[model samples]
Target: MSFVRMGIVGIGNMGSAHAKYLIQNEVPEAQLTAVCDTNPEKREWIRSQSGDSVQFFDTPESLFESGSVDAVMIATPHYSHSELAIKAFRRGLHVLVEKPAGVYTKQVREMNEVAAQSGKVFGIMFNQRTNPLYQKLRDLISSGELGDLKRTIWIITNWYRPQSYYNSGGWRATWAGEGGGVLANQDPHQLDLWQWTTNMLPKRLRAFCGFGKYHDIEVEDDVTAYVEYENGATGLFVTSTGEAPGTNRFEISGDRGKVVIEDGKLTFWRLRISERQFNKEYNGGFGQPECWKCDVPVRGVETGHKGITENWVSAILHGTPLLAPGEEGIRGLQLSNAMHLSAWLDNWVEIPLDEELYLEKLNEKIEASTFVKKSQCAKILDVRGTF
Candidate 1:
């Protein structure tokens, strides 16, 4: 195909924003040929916004069967990601899905298997992967510039949301709807980046989650999780939607040095010698390894959703490798599920978590939910600083 004929499912905030970007010629390789949403008002709004150049469909199945698009982007709810992506792949259309893949790993696994058999280019909207700062961090760790990893601490609580925000959507922050709260909605990028940059997954994790601590929602709004890697390295992840003017600091320590990303700045502490070597050879009782403070320079700008869309288009047209493959989406979702399961069980959960137990507990929450959702007009905030 000379240019990808793209269709977008779910005309919500993210989907509409992507449609506008494509229509305005932001992604030159993609054309907004078709759109689908269950709501007739959303379809009319998109047609009015973009003129009659785009086709609107009432159901995703009709959009897929109409041969209007060669690729599809799924921006639907948390649980529908896998189902929509699998349908796209089965229709011989490339697929790009938004983050968190799915609420649970089991469904995501099935989606991945179908994509593998279909031989379609499947990608996930891990837009943060396009950030230059994170790219530099991944390179440093992978190149062994930091020696062996020791610890990681990320206090990411800048995702403050008022009660009105949660009340705007009936599907939001509900066990039977969106799955989980901040971890599913706001923290997926950070969680994805954690394992992506380190190139490691936790062997076990123990989490303390405060359900409805900040809002009237039934899901978790505050969490603190302690994770352990197989190599004896440990980590701490703390996040919440309640704290105002909160911090977004990520610090990683290794035997050779340490790197810290905060306030949009990347800093590094370079050790003169490896800590293990220094400890083995040093004779002095009180001296530690010498270090030099350095500022890690990151090249290029932070290209968010637009960059990922362009990359997805390139992958479909020219066989360019995807920045975030759809199969890898499960890794981050696994971490989110593990944290929730650990909190529910009140104990440490191992990697490749017990999926059956997780599903059982999650179903219990859904069945026992007594949360009375409020009725409020949906408001789509400017999601610039939230990322």
Candidate 2:
């Protein structure tokens, strides 16, 4: 196959954007061939945009069986990602799922298992991975430019959303609908980048979450999590949709030096020698490691969702490597789930999280909940700047 015929399920905000670019041939080797949505208005809107060249289906199952597409992009709610991807993979099609792979890891694990057995290209829409700044950081850390990891701290709270933003969609912040707030919806990119750039997941985590603290919904709008990695490296992650004049700064301290990314720039502080080495050999009682501040150049602009879609198509057609393998999506979701679970239990949660326990707690939240959404109608707000 020289190109991929991509079908999109859930032609809502993100899904509609994918369709527009694909229809415009933004991806050289891909085309928008089919779409599925329960909303007749969305279907008609997409049909007007693409004409008869594209097929439309009211249900995902019909779309999967229509044979109009060689691959599928699942952009539905957080809870349906895994189920839809599993269905698409079973139908012998490549699958690309949106972030926060699923609400929990257990279902995502099952979806991943099926994708592995299907021998199909599976990708995720972790478009932030395409950012040159973050890419450079991951390269430096993995290439040992930052030496051994020591501590990592990220305060990425610039994801401020107003009450109307939550009101834009009925499923926006409701626990029974979208799963979790800030962490699940807004900060998946940062959480994924944190572990991906450092190449480590937490050994254990203790998270403090404020449910509905700033929003009129049931899920967390504020969070502070502290974690310890397997290498004895500790880390802190803080995020919220509640604060104004929010800050986004990611800092990493290594045995050799430190690196910081903030305000669209990355700064590196290089030490003459490892801090441990300097501390061990130095005779001065109050000496510090010699450090040099250098502004690192990050080449290329982030291609956003287009980059990921192109990569997924390339992986399907030309055997190219996927920038965001769908299997890895579970990692970020793990961090999100652990944070929520820790808050639910009011205690620490260990890594390799107890999935059964998490599910039980989640069910309790669903069953004992009295929170209600402001709107029950589905609305597709402009997702242009949201991500």
Candidate 3:
């Protein structure tokens, strides 16, 4: 209740990064009181890095039962996110989970349910939501300034990862260890931002995924999904970790105009008149609506992960609304799961997907996995400019 005593439940790359910021007092109104990790070396490393003043626990249960933290940030693996978060909620502590929610929707749904009944602040680490460029884009679409949306396309392939990056962790690309590859790890932020900015969910989708295409991994490294929205709008989402000098471009077209974000710039092409109106009124057979190109100015800085953590702390203290509520985490996860299921089944899969079938298929992949990963060296990369 005072200074929002915080505990982090993973001392991996992201957890250590958060610890450094909280220890450095970057997140106002928050204090790193307890750190939890199953690895003794990681615990000792964090202790050495943080002056040995912070409490260390070998398990999340111990950390939760210690009464040392008013809130907990679950930064563990994809499989453990929901279990740890549910436990935090049971202990009457605020919960902030790292993205993708979990490997599947069933567990995430259960976590959301427990969170709803707990009456505690539940948030997700969708740090990209704090980016001013994405915030501006969401505002534009939500304000209806772009008219009725017609189509969306995002080719986000800038998530390039080398073999050593995956080799650094045994759980990097395996189906049983990390669930899926790029979709589960590298592209969750973009996937979350895709639906968050558009404020739309696909009705159904068909996907093509290339498993072990670019690495000695068991999960997907390349993906292309075609989606159909409930409002008849369609979308094409393409992503890969294999291509170098890749592109990250997102475009949304509407009846009034089109908005595009690419290469750190936002561009808007405003039609003098709505395309729908122009089409209905035009007498000429070949004429089109006149368009004027405008540069959309996004004012403000990109705050990244620190911004989200501070916002979560502020929300717990002040009754402020969360930028990315934990309940909504399932939305982006649903999209990712749907794509994976579609590719696995080789057919179009509907939203609110067949959870049982997906789980069965995932388990099969886990059982059939023949990948043998090298010993983990566990190098912590500087993730500041990666996003």
Candidate 4:
């Protein structure tokens, strides 16, 4: 194929953002051939954006089988992601989905298998993976410059969203519609980045969550989770959508030193020697390892969504490796689930999550929800710098 015929399933905020850039020919080996959205308002919007060149399908079934595109990008709600991806895979098309792969891992696991069997390019929109700050962090960890991980703490309360943002649509923040709150909607990137950089998953976790703590929503808006890794490294994750004048800071401490990412800068505290070795060799009673604070230079601007879309096209046409493979999405979602499950059960949740139990508890929350969803209207927001 000269270029991958790209189709998008949801033309809401994120979807429309991708659609606009694609229509503008921002991605090198991709073209906007078609778009599918159940909302008629979205259809009208897509037409105005793509003119007569792009075909609009009201249903995924039509778009997948219509022969209008060679690949599909799914930007639907949290629950429908895996189901639609599986369908697109069965239709013999490449699939690129938005974050949090699915509400639960069991369903996402099935989708991964189908994608592997299809042998099609399956990717998730982990745009934060393209950030230079995080990319450098992963390099430092993988290259052993940071030695073994000791602890990680990220207070990412900058996901600040007013109640109006949640009230923009009925399906938002409701357990039945959007699954969870900040973790599902706002902080998937941070959740994904935490492990993507460290290459470690929590062995067990204890979390405290406040559902509708700062908003009139049925899902969590504030959360504080404590997690432990297999290697004995512990982490603290704190996030909220209600906190104003919020702070965004991530610190990764390792045997060699630690790196701090805040205010769009990476500060590396390098020890002259590994802490493990220092403990063995230091003769001074209380002297610590000599350290130097270096401003680790992170070059290049983060490509974000447009970059991921371009990478997906490159993978489709030339066998280039995807920056954010779809399978890796499950790991991040697993962390999110662990935290939620811990809070729900009011106990520590272990790894290898009990998928059945998670789903059961999730359903209980949904069944218990008395707040009625208002409307699934396409009230698209101007999501310029959301990620």
Candidate 5:
């Protein structure tokens, strides 16, 4: 039960949360060796909390070169994820990265290459995958109880961000900073969940995205993506930062029935089969032929970010399988980028999206744009469940 030496880069909102989870819990498996952030104040704040007298570095490379850490958790901006992950991996350190592993599919592929070469575990911080409700849904789908998942619609609009929420951080909502909105920040969880539960990637996508429709942000604050999966299944993914009192409702309809996750509960509606043998042969069918809403209770720890972090640390330190791997991250990022590209170009973008083209378009904007002034941003109105 030796503790794994750990270092964290970027002490922002998410980074700080990972640090807190590591130090304030029964993490007999990890020790915070150092913390790194360019901001002096953020570094100082982490020092005060952990009281590790741990060393702090000004740059990610410095943290890697210091030889003071065995593993590193990267909580930097979306654009920086690939660079930091590659650097840490090359240095022979295990890495954990925040959601949307890279801003684009190409960048993620490059990161995957580095991890493969390094032969180190690369974990993505898609914490929402650890939710029992999602876990059960994934299990049910994989178990084939649903009889071929046909369609999934995830209406997750409840990620409420106030104007000050975006204003509180300097590197938020800007293309040069976060790469995109809602999809990149608030909806990464839902996006990842969409792929994880269905276990299918869309073959093509058409999206309608509203940039600055509700907020004064430069990227999409609202998005609706129409997806056609390889198996001919369709999906509708919609989300927005403008909506308040929003609801998170996920429904998957298969040939047999439907699985709905809402209000923190999972309900399975089983379609009564005409073949009594099929019902009798199945483990969960109870030898009955009928359609009933089966309540699937959430199991395990309370659904929260901390639980995911604990599993992340444990999975790496011990031999526990990661809830979300870095490679799986690429699918979610591709989905997000596809939607953005489709909306931006006003055309259907194919899956395994044209990474080079997307990068080119993004670079053009990056080179031509000027940073938006926070003072110029319009006040975001608080609306309820309107995605």
Candidate 6:
């Protein structure tokens, strides 16, 4: 097996988590070669945690300039994701970017273009896509076992956060730092899951948002979006950071079955649909298809973040096919952007959304922003709910 040297930019929560996993698990084909962070305190802490033997730098450029790493994992704040990933790619390094690939669709597209030009593996940290229940649900939909999907409703309100959580960082809820609220941070995984399982793109989006309903922030704390796809299939996405005792329930209905991904489990109901109804040509009930539901156990074993991360390293070193391609990330980001645009303008927006328009709207919010955010949580509310 070929061994790949690894470097990490931004030694924050996710970065630190990745560092720990790399060092402790001893990924068979990967090695932790360097770590980077802007904060002196964080730099010192990483040195203490990893000892003097490993290299540490204060800027991503320094790490990339060293040319000692084969790949770099970016766990920085949202704004820097695109720039850093592009930089790493330009230096002939494979990259694994943390979720919400970038703060906006345009930035994510630029990173994707750079990755394509560089001819190196570019991966997104959509770890939830690796979860067993979600995998099973995706498989069912792809296999035709679920038949033609009609509607999907994801009531994922369980992403509860308190006021102090937002206060933990100045950047947490600010438009300038993070972009949006629930959609950017807590719900990127869910948004990506929406696209992955549906296997379709939206035709239009309409939404209503509650801006800072429970938190003192500029962006939304809760949001509800109604999406229509090209085939006339519809979807409902509901997310909130203020709701307590929340539940994450995803219900996807098709002509043959309905699949629910919730509480780390997959439940599916297989239905018998009537070809007979079509053949009968009834005068009164001409279009209605008769159906009966039967419970079907989701087929697939479980795998989570560790599985995806390990596979990512393996894919880089051994050419394994990716679970989630980096380019597909833009789809979810576009969906989020369209929803926010719809809610902000109080109108429905069509899909294949205009990236320039979204960026213009984002810039407007950035110019208008007044809130002082200091940490990750603050930035979270600002951009997360926007989408």
| Residue-wise C-alpha lDDT for candidate 3, range 1-387, written one tens digit per residue | 558999999988899999999999888799999999989998778778787778999989999999999999999988789888988999999999998798888878889999999999999999999988889889989998898999999999998999998898666798767879889998889989999999999999999999989988889999999999998899999999999989999999999899999988999999999999999899987899999999988999888889888888999999889998999999999999999999999999999899878877876776565542233211111111000
On lDDT, the stronger of 3 and 5 is: 3
Roughly what TM-score does model 5 have, to 2 decimal places? Answer: 0.88
Please provide, for model 5 over 1-387, each residue's C-alpha lDDT reduced to its tens digit, 9 standing for 90 to 100: 366788889888788887876777556577888989989898668768877567889988899999998888888877778878998999999898888787788878888988889988788888777777888889989988888768999998988788888787665787756778899888887888898887888999899999889877788899999899777789999899889888789999987888898887899898877333465577883455568888977778653666655666677767788777877888888899999899889999998888878877776554433453344321111011000
Q: What are the per-residue Cα lDDT tens digits for candidate 4 across 161-265?
A: 988998887777887777799998888899999999999999999999999999999999999999999999999999999998899999999999999999999
Please give the lDDT score for candidate 2.
0.88
RMSD of candidate 6 to true structure, Å: 4.0
Model 3 weakest lDDT span, ten residues long: 378-387
| Model 2 ranges with Cα > 4 A deviation | 370-387
> Where does the lowest 10-residue lDDT sum fall in candidate 2?
378-387
lDDT of 1 by residue, 252-279 (tens): 9999999999999889999999999999
- The Cα error of candidate 3 at residue 268, in Å, is 0.4
RMSD of each: 5.2, 4.6, 5.2, 4.7, 7.0, 4.0
TM-score of 6: 0.90
Q: How does candidate 1 fare on TM-score?
A: 0.95
Which clashing pairs does model 1 show?
Answer: none
Clashes of 4: 0
**What lDDT does each candidate get?**
0.89, 0.88, 0.88, 0.89, 0.80, 0.80
Cα lDDT tens digits, model 2, 283-305, are 97888989999898889989999
Per-residue CA lDDT of model 6 for 76-173, tens digit only, reads: 88877888888899889899888888888877887888899999988888877776677777888888888778899999899899989888876677
Winner of 1 and 2 under lDDT: 1
Give the per-residue Cα lDDT of candidate 3 at 313: 92
Off by over 4 Å in 3: 371-387
